[model samples]
Target chain A: MRVGVVTFPGTLDDVDAQRAARVAGHEVVALWHGDHDLQGVDAVILPGGFSYGDYLRAGAISRFAPIMTEVIAGAQAGLPVLGICNGFQILVEAHLLPGGLLRNDHRKFICRDQTLRIENTSTAWTGAFAQGQEIVVPLKNGEGQYVADAETVARLEGDGRVVARYVDVNPNGSVNDIAGISNERGNVVGLMPHPEHAVEALTGAGTDGLGFFTSLAGVLA
Target chain B: MPKPEILDPQGKAVLGALPRLGFTGVTDVRQGKRFEIEVPEVTEAVLAEIAKMADSLLANTVIENYTVRVEQDA
Candidate 1:
């Protein structure tokens, strides 16, 4: 499968994401945030970054990028999309996913290897993992707290759309320890951890995050 | 500012520092952004447009609450 990775002006993780896709046996397609075309890739990954310098709130400006128009439309039409860290913020800003990512409750930029429980494995990017499986990946961000209204939170929990939850400790004070979640259809997923950063054992903390990229094979098959 | 349902750590930090600085009697502090927009004229429609902008870009309604005040022609 061909996976497209988007590079916004201030994007910091596009290269890592593209490398992860390539390592997962998918053709990597470079996508520009300023361009409207998706290049007809089967899947898309919005990598971590401080896009637009995190000005006017993280991901708020990048949500209006020319490429997001196509991404939003394609995601709505069941095109698979995975958003990581800042990409998750963009997904929320675009209203493709519910809730918002706020500043960490501790008011610090935290970087650590976090353990996450896969709560729902039906999503396009998480199908490789078993339900309730624990995986370790790097979590780094300032605005990583996930927040939503009471009703939305209840609905997400009720529908079993929560894809991952922080294990051992809630690093960012995300609501209900939610580390990641998927849209109702399970095609679009927004995860706060840097899965792309964990695709390699030599450089990353572990190879646990490789499943996020490899799962697309089953999804596209 | 963060909505009532959301936690505002920045505001809490300000509140904590206020008491340490010998200032008291202030109950709360909520850090928020203030955008000074220069428009041709302040009208009902203009205010509505500004509200739309606030809802769309200026503030994220999910965790934030924003208020627009018209500072006429200044």
Candidate 2:
């Protein structure tokens, strides 16, 4: 399986994501935000960053990028797409995911080793984790707070679409302590944390995030 | 949707500073941006368009809410 990591302007984690995919036994493809082509990759990863310098909202301008027309089209057609951090914001701005991310309630940028529990391991991006498994990943962001109407939050929980939940502390006051969520089909998942950063012990903590990439390999197989 | 009242730190800062300048008995303050959108005319259709822009772009919709006010140029 070839996992394409999209490189957007100011994208900080595309290379790291590419390496994570490669280490998980999948070929890595470098996808560009300005290109309309997806390069025929089986899956796409929208890496973390301050895309377009967070102008007009975090993911606002990036959604209109040429690559997204194809990315959104392919995602709607059931292609597996994982959005991490700013990529998660892009997903919501692109209307590929419901709800929106807001500034942290306390109005501060936070960076730390964060613990998250697997709430729904059925998504294409999270299948490698056991149900309710706790994992630690590095989380860094300013506008990582996830928010939505009460009904939408209830529906996501009712349908078991929440893929991950923050454990110990609510890092950014995300509703329901949701660290991540998946689309109805589970092919599209978005999370506001730096999972790719935690893929290796040398760079980050224990390789708990390797499972996200490996899960895609499992899905493609 | 009615936006839940979350304390606006920026707005509070302005509220605190105003009293030092001799303005008295101010109960509250919620400072926000005001944009004068230039439209051809103040029609319901144009006001609706401005409202849409406010909802989708100008306002964050999560922490901050916005209201669109249209006034015709004399």
Candidate 3:
């Protein structure tokens, strides 16, 4: 399968995402933020970084880029989209996912290896994992706290849209300790943690994050 | 300081209950606050000051971005 990773002007993780895709046995394509084409890839990833320098709100400006128009259309057609960190912020800004990310309640940027429980593994990106599985990924960001109306939260929980939940401690004070969520159709997933950074054991964070990429292999096969 | 949205549902609900408990003429109420400061000199020094504000508090560099407007009042 071919996977495309979009690189905005300020993106920092596109290369890492590409490498991870290759490790999972897929051909990788580098896509530009200014382009509206998907390059006919089977899946897409919006990698992490301070896109557009996080101007006018994280992911706010990036949400309007030409590529997102295609991304929205592709996601609607059941194409899988995985958004990490700032990419997650962009997904929310674009309304492809619910909830808003806010400044860390601690009023500081946080970076650490975090453990997350796989809550629902039926999504296009997580089908390889069993429910309640624990995986470690790097979590780093200043505005990582997630918030939404109670009704929205309830609905997400009821529909099994929550994909992951933070374990041990709530790093950014997200409501109900939500760490990741999938869209209703289970094709789009967004999470604040940097899974790409944790994909290699030699890098020291452990290779548990590789499941995300490898899981897609099973789906595409 | 940035202008946050004032439609805090929880805060609004609490304020709405006040009028029923004897408060009157409270037509519609909303709550939010702004902060203002003056930089002593309008020079490179002021730009530096604004940059510090952006880094420290005016915006959450990780999630939010901000714009600054400076005006001179005689």
Which predicted model would earn the best TM-score? Answer: 1
Candidate-wise lDDT, in order: 0.94, 0.87, 0.83
- Output the number of the DockQ-best candidate: 1
Tens digits of per-residue lDDT, candidate 3, A69-103, equal: 99999988889999999999988887889887877
Off by over 4 Å in 2: B5-74
Off by over 4 Å in 1: none
Question: Per-residue CA lDDT of candidate 1, range A80-171, in tens?
Answer: 99999999999999999999999899989999999999999899999999999999999999999999988999999999999999999999
Pitting candidate 1 against candidate 3, the one with the higher lDDT is 1
Docking class of 1: high
DockQ of each: 0.84, 0.28, 0.05
- Rank all candidate structures by their DockQ, best first, as comma-separated numbers: 1, 2, 3
- Candidate 1 chain B lowest-lDDT run of ten: B65-74
In candidate 3 chain A, what residue range of length 10 has the lowest lDDT sum?
Answer: A99-108
TM-score of 3: 0.77
Q: Please give each candidate's TM-score.
A: 0.98, 0.87, 0.77
DockQ of 3: 0.05
Model 1 chain A weakest lDDT span, ten residues long: A193-202
Instruction: List where candidate 3 sits over 4 angstroms from the true fold.
Output: B1-74
Cα lDDT for residue A191, candidate 2: 94
Worst 10 residues of 2 chain A by lDDT: A99-108
Give the best candidate by lDDT. Answer: 1
Error of 2 at A89 (Å): 0.7
